[model samples]
Target: MMKTTKRSDRIDLRIDPKAKETIQAAALLRHKTISEFILENAMGAANEILAERRHFHLDAKQWEAFQAALDAPPRPLPRLERLMQEPGMFDGPEQEA
Candidate 1:
């Protein structure tokens, strides 16, 4: 599939002049525009943050257990079902303090 690199938004940041100069130097060293350098590095860090948030690295035994849990049929818990049927914290009452 063809991809587009059309930037249709803006993000303005205020930073120390020293930080800006440092970024400028880094960008020059990498032979990339300031925007490209920032986006590439920032996106790399962003991807790490998101991957850490969303993906798990399970060992073989843990993976087996995880798969088993997913494949198992639902178990009934009468207490839990009843608890859910009860009025929720915000519903139908003003509890005394």
Candidate 2:
């Protein structure tokens, strides 16, 4: 059984007629009300967006490997060093007075 939570919040949106129709069609296909469909998808998207910045879990071996990688020194990149040394396009020749 699913637990129900009390809802006391309201959100209003103004969408184009075509968008509304599309949403309504999708909701009907899923057998959900428009509000339920929108809220479900919206929350799913929100969770995905926030997930990357929020938290992650790793097993013991994975955690050890991760720590090892973090502790390892960075490798030198000669090409990247040369690229950095080269004057950028924005670093144009000084204008003559």
Q: Taking the tens digit of each residue's C-alpha lDDT, what string does model 1 give over 62-86?
A: 9999999999999999999999989
- Tens-digit lDDT track for model 2 on 1-97? 9999998999999999999999999999999999999999999999998997798889999999999999999999999999999989999986899
In lDDT terms, which candidate is top?
2
Q: Against the true structure, candidate 1 has what lDDT? A: 0.94
Model 1 lowest lDDT segment of ten: 88-97
**Global lDDT for candidate 2?**
0.97
